[model samples]
Target chain A: MSVRDENIIEVEGLTKAFGDFKAVNEISFVVKRGEIFGFLGANGAGKTTAMKMLIGISTPTSGKAKVAGFDVFTSAEDIKKNIGYMSQKFALYDDLTVRENITFFGGIYGLKRQQIKNKSNQLIEELGLEDVKNQLVGSLPLGWKQKISFSVAMLHEPKIVFLDEPTGGVDPITRRQFWEMIYKAADEGTTIFVTTHYMDEAEYCNRVSIMVNGKIEALDTPQKLKEQFKADNMNDVFLKLARG
Target chain B: MSISVRNISKSFKKVQALDQISFEVAQGELFGLIGPDGAGKTTLFRILTTLLVADEGSASVFGFDVIDGMNDIRNSVGYMPGKFSLYQDLTVEENLTFFATIFDTTVAENYHLIEDIYVQIEPFKNRRAGALSGGMKQKLALCCALIHQPKVLFLDEPTTGVDPVSRKEFWEMLKRLQQKGITILVSTPYMDEAALCDRIALIQDGKILDINSPEEIVAKHQHVIYDVKASNPHQLISLLKAYPTAHSVYPFGEYVHYTDQSGEFKQEDLHAYLAHNGLKEIVIQPTPATIEDAFMELAN
Candidate 1:
């Protein structure tokens, strides 16, 4: 392993154009291993478009990138197998039972039958879903469903996990618990990449990059960003950058 | 009073959405209704706007009863629901004009009222409402709501999905509107936004946890909260939870918000315990509480 291997994600001059519009205009960034990297942006600031490119789902018009040791352009399939993704819409099967949902996701990750059984039991126990394990996911509260969905996303033990606004509508208490899980994942050396509109969540990241008008406007730790912008919080810093 | 509610209560088939919730909004005040997803905010807004009748209790808008004075309230109040409700096929200008006509007025009559917000989206007037971005759609919805020159505006989560910049701009527009003496009542799940309102009512599980200005609410917290961080953040939470003096320990951003049962808690003792537990890079600092802390404390 070389110095570059220490970086879980590396991008330089990444650009994605739609006709005449540059959704992601020549952005560059790096994500160190075992760190929580927050990609912050206002809606329509090209955050999602950039994230899609990083996740290997969308292609960049011009760029150099590597995710989890795989080139994005040629090795997207290999990249997909090494990362987990959870979106705000929640990819869980609503009609499936909590236990069934876990098993189903594990199967998709190509886990063996015995491995799926062990992982499902462990996940259910960790989330305190013993009683509701057989209950349909739709019957659970929004918070519980969100936690379970996040856990399911991590079942395959991917090297990195990408969360898109995971706690958007969740209550503060539940959101706190979700962050606890995220911290646990990071502690275990799984690099975490997340995008959120919530500034408070942005503060939790080790490093954050803010996008404005389809370009990387600022990137630094939350504390430094606040100090550099002469602002009190990420919200104020974001406002200053966006207004500029 | 701009708005008043007396023992307002509503229930669905199985859930009691609001239970004896009562609050008053003073004239020209920017009041915030803060809560989570199932906090009954929408139900309250619906009742106040005369779109739904409360099972038990009454609400009044600008000295008019919501039940008997439905038409009067409808004419004087502007309501922007949680979801965007506009003619998707119609252009931005058409939506504004259509809403203005419904109130028996023209855009020119109230052009000054929405001028600050309208100008931002004026360049896209020819664009269909459906083609606008999230921020643009928000401005368009707000313009349509205000085209009628309502005395009181009821906005339900106006900036929920919008970006930080657009959210800031929207709040600035609200301040301008409030300066013109329009009492605004807004609801949002984001607790950080509570500070922007003149006063806020923190609602949870269909009950108002506490109603007061954001600063006052934070001042009311008797315990001194400490922000605790360590190399192993998760383990730190568990260790702090097991500590005898710990009153409440919850994950807050990059640190765990730890409050002790004993008024005089020792940081040295916490540091010793965390170190003994094999945690590294421990940093403990006293931090001022925010509206979020107050909400968690009250809800508990």
Candidate 2:
């Protein structure tokens, strides 16, 4: 398939249920390759549940999804192999040196030792972490750790990346630099799917989907969505949808 | 009914947390302390609430000095720290009653004060405080804080991780509380939230940068900001930054907020320059300053 024609993720009527309670109710959307798609919702709005299903970590009770051109249910392992994941919580080992953490994650992704060494060098220079390469991951500042976490996630060169609130506590300047990194990744044909409570970050996405009461309430470009809701910003757009 | 801080400074060993910070909260006024993390907001809140003594200077709540009137201040102030401090093992009702008993009052006595918030959480009164959702937990905490009907409320980043809906509802609750003559001093890292308060103090590096109403702060922005969008926003930022006339170029949402060294910037010149530089799908327009813009100006 051509890069432009490929949809990295395609979901139709995706639903997850625990007994009678539907955590994610009949959500459908398509994410194009190299696009930054934002999944947004209030706390307990089933965003996590839906995301778990898409990432092949949780089973869906009904409907269908295709991630990285593989069925979410039957090809879960293949899907996992082709995608990277990062969450608000730092996933790196705090006790390990920066180089050690990168090498370990690279090994988990089945990269060769030579490839790991080369990638580590490139990442260290790109992130300006050459001085801290030998320092323990825990001792670095939060902003540096966040940037490193993101770099490590992209080390394996996955087709798509999933970021769950990657900049929760980061300062504005750090957040801007983080977005630039995301843009660079997207530019390199890595589809980006992220979830965040920050409305400003939501505005940065190519398209955003807002969930309410376990269902997709609205999905569109930020500008179009704002115009549709007659709201000044994404926050107001979210408030109008969530309150309804 | 009011809070006054005069030259309050605190240090932790070698690191200075707060430096000569001074502000006044009028009776029943909703004041906001706005800044990023490690900006001395929590330190100031601690001193004002009588939880910690400043290394230097004086603070008073309701005309009572923090050092000498700790008991009086404790009696008349409601403090909700950034972290949820309620008993996780206790049920919602149990926690409320516990706080009431400690304050030498029953929930019934101040039922009127917490009715609006209480009724929302009443359905889940049997649930443990830990089991409640973030929004519900916030409401329950506020209810417990108000059980004694304190004259002043200090909320430290109360809506930090909350969703937009819950944040709006929480602000509405604060407005209601203000109507009941309760002075509120709230601190948050969210710049957009600064607008919700009656007055805001922008703080950074252990100092107050500016204090004014949100409108006044925005109005005081001297630069003419233009929201610029191009095919590639990241490249656009770098391009604008390298431009000789560009003063400040920062990424704001989807667009790059650009300001020129000169107040009088022409859109045609920018358009021609971008076109000459082989940029496409460019959109540039002047946008009104927001609380975040004002905060960014002061922060720099």
Candidate 3:
């Protein structure tokens, strides 16, 4: 199958349990390559648990899944190398300069030195960060740092990038700009697996899955989900599901 | 005024956290400080709560100067910082008791002050606070903040990362608190929450941009926002931005919110331009402006 038509991630009956409690239970979903998929839920709604399994960090108690065409059970290392991840709390190294951080991430992703240099320059230029390329990431503004962190996550040209509540607490303009970057990445055929608290952001995704308790309660286009739930917006839809 | 701030300024070494900013919150009013991170919301709150002193300007809470009458202010105000600050190892009830003791009171003395918020977490009283869910942690923190029945409350982004359901529920609690005549000075990055405030000061980059009722702010500066959609949103955004008359274009939800530089213009001219550029199913409808739109305009 062509990259556009193939599923970058396929999961069936994904379950993760700690003792007697099922954190993520019997969840099944397919993420097509280049699609912006929003995984949303309430705060303690097992998103982190499910995400850990998908990223190859935490082992699933029972399930069959493939991430970046690699089986989660046997090829966790391969899945790690083929996917990129960034979160609001943790992204680039704070003490590292913008250029150095890019080079570091690129090297970690197995890029050659020359390739790292080229990508660093292109990335800095794309973000218009040439002036502050040598400044420590710690000194930069939150929006600038967030944008740089996101671009750095894609430094290795990973097939998919997972963002966790990436836009929380950012200014309105910066949040939209961040989404624009996500849109550009998805357009370039990198599947974007993102989670956000902003309901409007859920609307930006091709498909959104709202998790209630430990199961996927609703998954569809924002419009269809709204219609199905008889809600006016994603906020109402989320409230209706999460409150239940 | 319940809270009064004038020409307040503070800096951390080289960074000016709060510029010469000023505003006032009347008694029993739900005042919101709406802005994103590093907009000086926390700095202002800290100064008012007597945790930090401003380099310039003066602030008074409940008629007590923040610089000189800190103890008086402390006794009259309740503050909940953005971060979860309750004693994690302590049980929910124990933490509430600790805060109440520190305030020279007992939970029973001000039980009614937090009765509405406390009952929600009473079932989990014996559970360690660290094990509580995010929503429950916020509720418990709120209860602690109100344990002493302070006349003024300062909540710094209490719902920053909370989900929609919890955020809604928290706001409802704030409304209830307000009805009880407790003046609140709350800060949040979420613009939608601005409407819940009686008046909001749209702040950014260490300065207050505008302070008004959320309704008047949106109602006055709407300037005819247009909701534009096309076959390809990415291309549509770029094209609209390149249009000579485009004032601002930002993707809201499923559509791009566009405004003309001139505010009012011919709709056909733009429709013809998009259609000529191979765009299909073009939909351009006027939509009401929101706090986000007003912020973008003023911030832009």
Docking quality of model 1: it rates as: medium
The segments of candidate 2 whose C-alpha lies over 4 angstroms from its true place after superposition are A1-3, A75-77, A90-104, A107-114, A130-141
Model 1 residue A126 lDDT? 92
Question: Best candidate, TM-score-wise?
Answer: 3
What residue pairs clash in candidate 3, if any at all? none
lDDT of 1 by residue, B128-166 (tens): 999889899999999999999899999999988778888
Model 1 steric clash pairs: none
Best by lDDT: 3
Ranking by DockQ: 3, 1, 2
Lowest-sum lDDT 10-residue window in model 1 chain A? A1-10
Give the per-residue lDDT digits (tens) of candidate 2, residues B1-300.
399999999998766889999889999999999987778899998998888989999999999999999999999999999899999999999999999999999999999999989899999999999988889999999998899989999999899778888988899999999999999999987888899999999987699989999999999999988999887666787788888898878788877888899756799889888878878999999999888777777777
What does candidate 1's lDDT look like per residue over A152-227, in tens digits?
Answer: 8899999999998888767889988888788788878888999888887887888899999899999998889988
Error of 1 at A230 (Å): 4.6
Model 3 ranges with Cα > 4 A deviation: A1-3
Better of 2 and 3 by TM-score: 3
> Per-prediction TM-score, chain A only?
0.97, 0.97, 0.97
Candidate 1 i-RMS? 3.0
Better of 1 and 2 by DockQ: 1
